[model samples]
Target: MKILHLLRLGAFVAADKRLERKEIDLRKLEKEYEEEDDMELEDLDMWDERKPKQGMDTRKLDGRDHITTWSEAKKGQQLGMYVNTVPGLSEVELKNLFDLWQMNMINCCNFELTFLPLEEERMLVLLPDGKHLKDFGTMLRQDKNCLTFVVENTHMLCGGHPEWDPKRPGKNVEAMEKWDQYHKDKKIEDTKKKVEGWKESIPVENKDEL
Candidate 1:
């Protein structure tokens, strides 16, 4: 009878210890949730601060007009290059080329290199300004080794894509609208072409089925 009583006591103690551990875990989870809620509230406040003030000219505040004029003035400041494959050239050689250009030709600001999405062979190089970009183009044109590459001013390629002008304080809403329309029109044209191609591809007998 004494041995049975001791066994019961041991089981009760183990269950009590388990309950205490579960309570501790619950408290820790609640503390974590409280911290997350505090962070979310802080983010909401920051977002509210960015809202435009009532009765204010949003264009003036956003720098739209200023950016438009600045973009026109500094038109070809950035350049985009399409890098074609160079036979027998290693990655180290390509890096050396970029390093050489940065070290010698680029002044005031450095070049920004970005690879095109899904196309590793293509790259876009953002030059410092119009003058430097023109100079770089001239050098590339003269160099026989760079024949495979194609370079053009970004404005030429994108019909003046709206960008933030450092000299301006506001956003370029007008340019942004124009770019949006351009892309919309291009999309419509592309869709029309695809539909026309599909229609032509269908046989006269199969046209009823489609």
Candidate 2:
């Protein structure tokens, strides 16, 4: 009689498990249906023509715009470049830097370096003005193993003449080789340090204790 009672309890539990699975399946189906409905609504909305929403002219926002115009866009040409004046950077300093960079890159191509994008990698273009910037020059500076030569003298560096000739093949080849070696050496050193660190972090086991 006790065994029969236990069998009845087991049947009830099995029925409950099947019912729970059906509930879960129903929930998943309902969620999928809702997602499909959302996607359809999005597609319909895309067909509707809409204009960009303009920001409301608030006094606080208007004040900042006015300050930017007076500060960065002090000149006629720079007025176009003035998006917003960053904090801490003075208006005059920002304008001067922007004008110098723009004229050096666009007007004169007088940059110390010019970065050209390649299929797999990008190439740096060295222009006259780029030499003045610490980061730009540092990137091109060669180590003992690499060759470093002046592509442009003081005359060309100053943006003295409007027209400048192309870089020499000899200089280009030497610079490229140097940069390649520098990167290779750096990679090898980094790998060695990483291996050393990993070995140090490994726990030492005692055979006697085991």
Candidate 3:
């Protein structure tokens, strides 16, 4: 009977040791998990730091460095307008009429005229101010030589320059491709890290079961 008691005590001591070792292992795992969480937070902070701040301009990110928003004209200058000529008017006739009209109109003294090479029926007129542009539009609506006109302010009209032709390929295509590849590589790296961490978290004894 004494031998049996000694054997039982030995079993209990072995069980106790196993329990203590398991507890120690659990504590180590918890510490490692906390450390991984801290590392993830630091990575997130670093990524956030690389992003554009709120209300910050992001034109450079998208390769729109050549584009600029239209700003208000200064006191003495004015934004330009596109004028459409009468459908039947020849280029020479339109030019002659524009020259005569511009020379005669006292309000257009401070204005400048530019002829775009696109179409003979179209020209750009730069008036002195908003008030002058309004008056010019009113006069143009009454004139027989004019068809229609538009103020060149919006993105569609302003961006229709020959340099920004839609038929041409975008200048930033390669940059965009690089940006996409960068994101893909980062995603792959993150996935690999997650898989490795999951593998490390599994116990060696339980690996055979998986």
Question: Candidate 1 on 17-43: residue-level lDDT in tens?
Answer: 655534344444444555555544433
What local lDDT score does residue 31 receive in model 2, on the 0 to 100 scale? 43
On residues 128-199, what C-alpha lDDT tens digit does candidate 3 reach at each position?
A: 443354445445545667655665432221122222333432323344457799999999999999988887
Q: Taking the tens digit of each residue's C-alpha lDDT, what string does model 2 give over 35-89?
A: 6555444332222233222233343232312222222222111111112122344
The lDDT of model 2 is 0.35
> What lDDT score belongs to each candidate, Candidate 1 first?
0.45, 0.35, 0.51
Candidate 1: the clashing residue pairs are 62-170, 62-171, 63-170, 63-171, 64-171
Best by lDDT: 3
> Candidate 2 at 83: error in angstroms?
47
Identify the runs in model 2 with alpha carbons over 4 angstroms from their true place: 1-171, 206-210
Quote the positional error of residue 197 for candidate 1 in Å: 38
